[model samples]
Structure formats: structure tokens, C-alpha cells
Target: MTKKTKSLVVVMAVTAMMLAACSGNGNNNGEQATAKPEATGNTNGNAGADKQEEPVTIKVLAQFGRADLTENEKAFFQKVNEALNIDFQLVIPPSSGYAEQLQLTLISGDVPDVVFFPSEQDEMFINAVRDGAVIPINSYLENSENLKNYSYEHSWEALKTMRDDNIYGVPRTSITRNDGFMVRKDWLDKLSIEIPADNEVTLDQFNEILRAFTFDDPDQDGKQDTYGVGSYVDANKVLLPVLVSELGHYGWQKSTDGSYPFMLPEYDAQSDVYKNILLYTQKLYAEGILDPDSPLNDSAAASERFKQGVTGVIRGFAGHVNAQEKVLKEIDPQAELTYLFVKGPEGKVQGTGYGTGIWGVWAVTAESEHPEKAIQAFDYMLSEEGWDYLYNGIEGVDYKLVNNEKVYNPDISRGIATSIMRRHNAPEFFLDPTKFTKEELDRVSPWVDKAVATVVTSMDKGYVPPAAREPQYMDYKLTWDELTTKIMLGDLPIDQLDKARADWYKNGGEQYLKEMNEYIQSLEN
Candidate 1:
């Protein structure tokens, strides 16, 4: 159980099954119904003609999005040209600095063949559409055999909202992150407490178990040292379902009236939800049952609490299963942890997907003389060969599937080391779940729960599409995030909840609702 012993064990990556990606250009999650005139329109933006033989290098204008890829990344890029016989000069910057860069590029009349954009509330993309900086790609849809098929097979509603009659770029699809409670099972056995069904314990019931685990001295140290829950406020943990639920609304829950939009209180707090969340917070606050500093702690701090045997419950997404097991094993050599799906206030469960934002978008610049090559390059990314190349660098170099499950070619590690921006799991980006085989999913799953649970498929997964972005509505999102944090932290008077809702209306919350209504109704049409 020493750090030395833990460091010696090579923790494998999370099971690779759940990695999931996009609809098409004009498939923005924005709220709107941009009408289109069918696919038979005239030649728009120089659609392709079969295959072009010219080997011209097209320059792409990508947003500040692509990773600061490590050596593994460079190898993967090389593989694209080696396998697909296509070359592209990807023009991507950092995602954090992308918006400002995109603006300057647009003004300069230099646009990428494809740019990563949110169908909802992305200012740069909207402005580009208004100024004709981006091609209305709906007409281009007809020429795309792969895209047309992908669009029809999947729901087209999201794509429809992003554009009128032209598809601009491809819409990024996402995976619904199916995750749950991260409890150290070895400790549970020590305490002889039954592991709840798929770890689905009710709020009160979960607290009872956590309290026993923490205070009853399950560790047998005979000290009043353990806490019920372990959590942190770091970026990754902030988006987690458990932390998300505590604040209100991480998973998209629907309302009875279907009139009010579902919101994670932090991301989208409904008035009623916020009021109810107070009761839970009040309970934890009063019982001294929760970690007092969870609000300030980051993921590592919270996880450390669990490792130190100071807290019982550690909630996180599915991917953490493997890592959690690895870390906690140092505490108890037999530590085992599994996914626990989160139950909402109503006791119903919901999961989140890969955001339809920057992570999934990749682009080629308009500056390229060979725009056709850019499309081809992107299409190659969607191909099985391209995906495999991305997942692991050039075969026999970065990795080799000895028995089917990929094992890195030890030599590849010499030239490159793994880090945040790059890893062997890169292929999940374009691997089509529709085409995903059980073996493939097992090989590339992002979360450990993929084997135990099937991800829920949904056409309406809180995506508002491109036309959904309105100035007033965006303000509502901003204000809601700001105020909800204040309310959760007890900075705002609890009674101010109603006033906040009204203020929402005054500050265009009402218009936002109306806009959402129109988009929802459009689903019917």
C-alpha cells in the first residue's frame, strides 16, 4: 500500500468502449429553423467532382482548438498522409484563444474550409454566416454520399437548425457520458455493507451508508477522522454528474409541461429545482456530513481525501473507474470501484454526452486552393483507417495489436511520452458508434462502465442547434451560471430565488424561453 508499490503497477487506460463525435455543417445546436430549398440547388462553393488528382496542399483555418499534440500526435498526423495519401496543413490554434483569432481571420476574408463551431450561441460562426464568410453548405449536402447517408441515418433536426438551405460544415456528434458513484468496494466488503444496485442508492440512503463508512470507523483507526463524501471544484469534477446534480442540472431533465426547458442549476437552473436543491445542501451543511472544503477543493484534493481514508463517497464520470481503482489500491490492495449512475431529484437517472462544442470540431481553411482535399482529409478522419491511425500512431511504430487489443511498441514510448493533450485514445473522436463493433468498443472505451451499461441514445439531448443562439438567451445562460453558484455558496438570499427568475425574464429570460419553445416545436414539424 506504499507509493512505491503503486508506482510500479502500470495502470491501463480506461476501457475504450464509450468513445463517441457530429451531424454535419449547419448542424449547430443553436435554436432556430433555418429553412432550406432541398439538395438540388446550383453549384455552390465549388462542390467536388469525383476525385481530383492534383496534390495541392490546402491551408485550413482552424480555430484555436487542436491539441498541442505530443510526439504521438505528430506520428498520427504523419499516418494520415501515409495511409490516406492526403496532405493537409491544419491551421488550428488553441481553443481558449480561438474566438478572437477567428474574428480577425473572418475580417480578412480568410475562412477555413471547415471550422469547429457550436450550433448554439457561437458568435464567430453566426457573424460569418451573416457576412457570407462561411459557405451555406446545405446545397453541398447533395454531393456528399458519406454525409448524406450519415445525416439521414442519424437525426437531421440538429443539422437543419444550423443553416437555412446550405450546410456550412460538419456538425460534431457527442457521446452521452454514462457514469456513477465511485466507491472503493474493497472497503465496503470490509464494512460488510451491500453495494447498492448499480450503486443507485437514494439520497437519504446514500448518506446513511456514507456516514457509516466514514464515522463508524470502517477503516478501524478508532478516530473521528473520516467524512461522508469526497469531492472537488476543479474543472473536470465541476462537469461531473454528481457535482453537477448537487448544484442543479448537469444531465438534461425534461419538465412535465415540456413548456419549461430542463436545466442543470449551474448550467441551467429551473426555479423549482434550485429551491429543492437547497434542502439537500441544508442537510449536508447541517449534518457536517459532507466535506466542508469540497467547494474549494479540486479533483486531486478530493480524491486525495478518499485515498487518505478521510471520505467515503467519491463521485465522478465513468472514465475514472480504472484510475480510481489504481489509486485506491494503494490504500487497500484489493480496492475495486465501478460506475454508479446518478439519480436526479425525482429519482430518475440521466447522463451527459460529449459537448457539441470545440472538442469535436476540426476544420480546413478557405485559403486552400485545394478545398476538395480538405474535405477529403476530414472524410479520411471519419474512415476506419484514419480513426485507427489517430487512436494509435503509425502501426508497428506507435502500437501493434498483438492479440487484437493494442499494445504499444515499446520503442514508440522512447520517442514520445504520454500527457494530457495526447494519448492512445485519440481515435474516439471520429469512430462512428453506429459502426462500432463490440470488440472495437471494448478496445477503445473511454469509461469502464461500457461493459456493464449501454449508453442511452437520444435525439433531444439538450442540443439547441445553430439557430438557437439569440443575444438575450445567451445572457440568460451567463446569468444563470453566475447566480446559481452564488445561491449554492449561500452568497444570495434563498428567498431571492423567485426574484432571480423574474430578473431572468427582465434580462431576456422570457425571450430565451420563447426562442427555445419555437425550436422545440420545430421538432414536431
Candidate 2:
């Protein structure tokens, strides 16, 4: 039998065994095998009067992007302590080494009370659940309306898929927004290139603009130094933003075959969409319109190149336009940016979707003395008063209310405030009117709105197939990276992608498809 058929057979056999086991155990209701501990103290409120008398110390291990906490971050923690009446022993390692630190912590059997996992699909997290190192928070989640209501349903479903149908973590919510190409409006005006009225450009128009930007001296610098586009390689492949305008999809697409409901559009058997994207990119590279250093650049390097005026166009986040413009203007006062919505060959203007609306997850460890307090702390972060502090920071310290309008303190650092604890995935939080002046809002709002409106989410977003974690799958990913990069750089012919696709099936791709579809089917049933 083919690998795909074998995978389906294995899935069916496993499902049958699971059914038989449930029938024999008289526990077919899909409940946890071990009885979960009842959450202690008041579940609705933060820290109750009785609990405040004897403060509970909850240790929290989280990922902080920076090396150390800023003064505002310290104050934010102090505020949380006063409100919650919980002594939070925070273990904030730098984000660069956090995964390694987390692995070490798990291996040492010294896991914190509340652990923050950067990814829900982390193998360590899976093993921790299997080893009973992390406790299921379903009982606590049932009582915490703020936690449950604010978090996306898909996030809970994703966590449930990891272990039985039990939520093991509190989702650190993130707003699902799109990113698109930000072009130099100054350059466009200098070259007298008129974009479409709706800001969406056709593929042919896009190519011409790139040529103009590269060859027509759009910067008016009298130098042939600038490229048309700036991009970086992520995971040894060209960044998605650079190709999404052509491909129309980010990662996975709903399969034409019902047996395997999801397929990676890049390796899809029915179409040459991915190959066409590579050829387009190759043409740009050959014509010197695409950045030469793109294969060597990371996200930071690519952004820097754009900011320093090395390139006229680069992929940018919708919400970060104002900040990016500020940086660009610092170098050249006349520099201006505008977002572009490129109409794909399929006649669609689209941007990639962020799956599950979750950036990270917070799980309570079984070693905790007060799992209930940890849950309460997380729930509090989602509350109005708590979210206000997390999002806006201390009212007087971070911002002052003047005529019922928030006036932010310019000196205070608000970098780590909203993300240090948990986040609520509200678009209003990111696009807060109070944070920007009228001029900035008028300039940035349209792009943000456009991006949000054009997002195309994947069909199999939150589901992780079992075969994905296999060594063969990882090997296939490496092979994919190498082959795609080489093809884009013109080192290999376009037809080589066919070999990569075939290699993918040989190396766990067939099983990956079967397992993901089965999981998706189970959800539907």
C-alpha cells in the first residue's frame, strides 16, 4: 500500500483502539483519567480579602524579549502585586535563550508554578503534559469567564489536540492582523508613477514600478545603488510577504481531495502556483530589481536596509507603519511610506493570516502550591482593570487622563507592559487612538484597515499533525528550504520543485497529510 493509504489505516486502527479502550474503561465521555484538583480561593475575583491576609507566592516563568526589565516593567509588576495580593516570583529569561532555559528547567525537574510556552506545539510542552508535569486548567477555565471569553476558541481546540480533550494552558492572545508591502511614496511621486485608486496594483503594474524604482532613479540621488524590493530569508526560504502577493496563500490550503482536506499550496500536485512565484522572483533577481543580499539577510537586517534607504519597498506590519515612517524620516525628512495591496495573478488582493490568534500560552505546573492563584492571576490580566494596566500601564505613571483623554508619558518605556503577562487579542488594543496624534492616526489608519480587510486565513490553521514532529518531516523541511532557495537564486531549474514535492511524500508528507485531515475530520464530527 502507498504511504498515504498506510497512514489512513494506522489512523483508523488507532481510533478503533481508542474506542475499545474507552468502552472497556467505562470512561467514553472523554474526561481526564486523573481527577483534577479543585481550584482554591475565589475564582471570580482577583485576590479576595481572606486570601490577601495570607498571600500566596506564585512563581512565573515568562519570555521577555529584552535582557532585563525596564523601570516601567518593574513598576507594572509592583502594581500587579498590590492588586492581586500575590507574591509573584518572576523568572524572566531573555527571549533569545528562553527555549533553551525552558528545556533545562524541565529537565532539572524545577519547573515554575506558571510557565510560559512560546509555542503550544512545543515538544517539551507535549512531554510535560504526558509526564504530568503540567496540570489541566479546564476546571479553572470553566470558572474564569474573562480568560475563556477573551481567548479564541481555536486556541483552546489547539491545546486540546495536544493531549486528551483538556485545556492545558491559558492562551496569550494576539490580534490576527495582516502585513503587506510598504513602498516609498516619495519615490513613487518622484518617478511620477500613479498607483491604482484603491492602492491595489496589478502584477504587470507592480513589475513596471519595480523597474522604474530600480532604473528610473526614483530617489533622485543620481546613483544606481538602490534596489526595488528589500526582503529577508526566514527558515532558509524567501519570506512569505515577498511572494504572498503572487501565491495568494501563505502556507496550507484546503485540498481538492476530500481524503486529505489540507495541502501545502507550495507543493500542491494540481498547480504550478509555487513554481510561478519562484520564476517571478528569479526574474526580479536576474533583473537586479530584488535585493541581492536578501538570501543573507534576516528580518532585522532587511528592515534596517529599508530604513537606511537602501531599498524603496519592504514588507511591513500594518500597525508599525507610523514607527517605521518615523525611523525612515529620521534619515531623510522627505521620505514617506504607503501600503500596497498587490493584485495576484488569480485577481485577488490578499495578505497572510495569523492562525489561532495566539502568540504564546501560559500553563500552570503541577509543582505549584497554588494553581488556583496562578489561574486567578492570568484571569485578572484579561479583566478590564487588569488589562487597562497591562495595555495602558499605570494610569498616572504611563499616562495621565486630561479632560477624560489619555495623555501618555513620553519618557516612560511601554515596551514590555502589555506582553509581560498575558494579552487580549483586541484590535483596539493595538490601534489605540490615544497612543497617536491626529496626524499620525490619519496617515496610518487606512493601511491598517486595508490589511485587516484583506487577510486570507488558512483552512487547517490550528491543527498540528502527529507526523509533523517526526525526523523525516524536519528533514523534508530542510530539503524544501535548500531546493526553493537554490531555484529562486537560479542555481537550479524550476522543474526541480517536482523532485522536492516527491521527496516530501517520501519523507513523512503523506503521513502528515493523513493525520492532519483525520484531526480536522474529527473536529467536524
Candidate 3:
């Protein structure tokens, strides 16, 4: 079979298996799959399970991508069941409706023992902490050497606290450069365009490249159906550094004084730099340089366009590169992609405020029967040994270490539904480098290095709106949306941008700035 055909076959098999697995649903019995060490007389002395303590059952409220466990997943549970003297009744909410389900559960006062606050559940977590719905684990954490060590590498200080000074949650970190731009390198080669130095293209060179992509038929099919770029307004904010530099701050500007940029005169929408971005986007829309449907399309739509080879340039997280390449390669084996940093006049700059350093957090609810056991279980899970077991499967079964690099079993690597491997942590965790192969390590090395460098760069250049200013940010965002829509539709002239800025300050902008700085001062003092 052809390579493409083989990939399809493998994907189909994985899909079918996944369907079968999900279809065979069960209650939270996986937690009870293991017999007690005393009953089974199985005392191998795993690092996680302290054989001395009698097993305790704990309920966990976790986010699940889907319901039901694959055979491999079942095995993973069975292993954990034996390793730890804890019975875990996993309450998994459907991935699609997790937020709504969790919200309703919270409203009903049915918070579980150990609640997982994934990235999507941030707001809910904050409210829970504020309302005293979750128990604070600060004292427990101080005693956990493993969790404490893991916390140091991530944004534990910020993540642990809410409005209060006490630590309320344990953070999970996924450390990697999540954003970058990529182009169809095959198209560049086919069109005889020289790849720019250091994979950085100047604005003029990039425009030329886009022009060729749009008009010169770089795909060589003699059809004028291709678009130069695939971008939505959200992606544009990142892919176009000029806009990011001027209007980049989420809401609050970089200020030790906590000054709000939106409320300031100099950073108003009518400013020269800000106007350039607006006009440039308008120009792109008018000249067919940008995706015609970009304003209306969402990220998934743009991704579909790229997959169908309708666009040559796209921006996304670095981890998405492999997924994009896989899809594009399936369409045309010759299709090749490469990362690029498009440089504006100011030089190459990545989008700031990409993340809050914490993916999600874990908190214990007062309702948990055994809060200590729940915390202990989670503490162990974040340890080096537990991380290895949870991230990889059984050492010799699901993966093998060759020269200190982990090689996953074929079934796991091919996306088969299995219990022996998982990447999700109930509360918090980070990627383990020792589990990566040489090729995987090399592919992600640049992104990893760039992630570290960008942290420092972003500290000086990035603008993160203080959490206290979320409401003000929302109001400003609503106004900007209206203004952007008007500007794009030509209903409002470009010169009227100044009026919009003035109107923003008149509408709670001043109050927002004053309150924001006050909150910042309170935190600092």
C-alpha cells in the first residue's frame, strides 16, 4: 500500500477502536480495579504506593476528552490501583460540555473531592476559591517535597493564590513555545523563491511572497484559486507583530504604576502605529492578499483551508506543526512546511501574552471525605517516579528506554486507544524530557529554547492585563469589536478612530485605569 493509504488505514483502525472503546461505557469502577496489597500479597514496593498505609477510596472530578477507557487505559488504572493504596472514582465530564457540566455541578454544591481546573476551567476555579468551595492545600503542599520541587519550575506563586494571600491550587505546566508561523516550503521551492535568511522574511519580501502565492500561481496548477495567507482576526493579532507591538497588551500596559494603555492618550486607536495595522488589514482585505473569508471564518475553517492546500502561509502554535504537516503531507507527499518569523520594520517579535504560565490547577473541595489522601495521591502523581509511570506506560510493556530515550510502543505511537499511556494530570504536571526520543527532541528543541528566551524578551515587551482588570478589559473589548467592525465595513472612516478612543475613556476607561492601579498597589504592598 502507498504511504498515504497506510496512514489512512492506521488512522481508520485507531478511530474504530476508539469508537468501540467509548461505546462500551462503565461506571467509575476503574478505580476499584485493584485488590488491596494485603489481600493480593503483591508487595513489589513501587515508589508511589506506600505498602504500610491501608488503601483509601477518593473521588476525583477530572476533565475528559471522552468517556470510557480503552483496554490500555484500564491497564493504566489497574497499575495505579496497585501502586497507590487509593481507590479513585474518576468523575469525567464530557470534553465538549465539560464547562457547562462543571458549572452546573458547582452551582448545585456538588463539588468533588479533588477538582481539576484545566485551562478552560480557570474562571470557575477562581470563583470556587473565592467562595471557599475548595479547601486550601498550602500546608499540605509545604510538606510534599515532590510537588514543591515541581511547583518551583512553573508559575506556582501566581497560580496558587486567588484574591487571598493563601495558596489554593496546584498548577500544571506545559512548557513549550506554543506559537509560530509556518509556510508551505514546497510552494516556495516550486516558485523559485529564495528562502529568507534565518527563516526570517522582511515585510517587503513577505508581501512579495504573498503576491506570488496569490497571483503567480505558485502551486503551478495554472489556477488562480489560492490565497496568500490563512488567518482570522485572532491569528492576525499574533502573526502581525506591528499590531501586537502597538495594541498588544491584553488590556494593561507594561507599567510598574499599573497604568492602563487603553485609557492613555498616546496608545489610542488613532495613533500612527495603531492606524497602520488597521489600514494594513483593510488593505489586505481589499487587495485579496488575506483570506477573503478570514473576518468571517474561525480557526478551524482556516485550518481546513490550509489542509486543502488553498493557502500557503499560516500561523499557529509550535506543537501544531507536526499535526499540520501530517495532514498536508497526506494530500501531497511533496508538501513540505517550515517555521518562519515574519519581521516587520521593528524586527522579528513573537506575540506576547500567549499564556498565564499555568495550564490548569487542582484544588481540594471541603466535601472530599479524605482530603489528606486526595492531596497525597496528587502529590505522588507529580513526583518524578509517578510522572514517568503516568506519562509513559509500564516500563517494558508500553515503552522501552534506549540510551535514556523513551521509545513508545507501536500501538501507543500510532494513536491506538490504550490505557498504558496518558499525558493528562488530574491537577497539575509538566512535560518530562527523558521520555522524548532523539528525533522528537531535535524537532522541539528550537521551540523549547525559544520558549525560554521569549520569557525574558516578553517580560520587557509583553503586556499582561492584571487579573483584577478583567471586567474593564471586557468592556474595552466590546467597544473595540464594534469599532473594528465599523472600520472594516467602511461605515466608519479611519479618521474617526480618534473619536472611538475618546469615547472609550468616557465609558468606564478612566475608572478602569484607577481601579486597576489600585488593585496592583494592593497586591504589591
Q: After superposition, how far is residue 455 of candidate 2 from its true place, in Å?
A: 2.6
C-alpha lDDT values of all predictions: 0.49, 0.72, 0.58
Per-residue CA lDDT of model 1 for 1-525, tens digit only, reads 533213211110010111111212221111111111122323222224222343344444443324344465566555444433344444444344445445555565544445565443365665655665655444444544544343222233443335344445554434334455677666577778775555565666666677787667767778878777765554632312234453344443445444464333322343465566654554564466677777778878877887776777777655445656667777777666654544556675654442332223333334435555555555555455554454445556666667786566543442211111111123353332333455555633544444224333332434553333667656565675566555555567666667667777676666555555555555545
For residues 248-365, what per-residue lDDT tens digits would candidate 2 score against the true structure?
5566666765545666677686767778778878878878999998888998998999998888888777678788888999999999988877787678777657577678878888
Give the TM-score of each candidate. Answer: 0.66, 0.81, 0.75
**Candidate 1 has what TM-score?**
0.66
lDDT of 3 by residue, 1-525 (tens): 544324433433443445447657533321212222343447244445666676776766566555565555555555555656776556554554456556655665655667777752367877888898887877777667777665433255465455465777666554434245678888989889887546656677778878888998878898999988877645433223213332233223344332342233224443365666666666666688777767666678888888888988877655456667878989988898777665545565444443445556767887777787776766665656565556655667677888986677666531112221122222111223334545655675565454334432232111234532567656775776667655654457777777777766676655555655555454445
- Which parts of model 1 are misplaced by more than 4 Å? 1-52, 61-79, 82-85, 92-104, 110-120, 143-163, 196-205, 231-274, 298-304, 328-336, 342-349, 352-360, 363-366, 392-394, 401-405, 411-507
Q: Per-prediction count of colliding residue pairs?
A: 54, 0, 4
Index of the highest-lDDT prediction: 2
Candidate 3: where are CA atoms >4 Å away?
Answer: 1-49, 71-84, 96-111, 118-127, 145-162, 174-178, 196-198, 233-251, 255-273, 344-348, 401-406, 413-441, 448-452, 455-477, 488-492, 521-525
User: Which is the better candidate, 1 or 3, if ranked by lDDT?
Assistant: 3
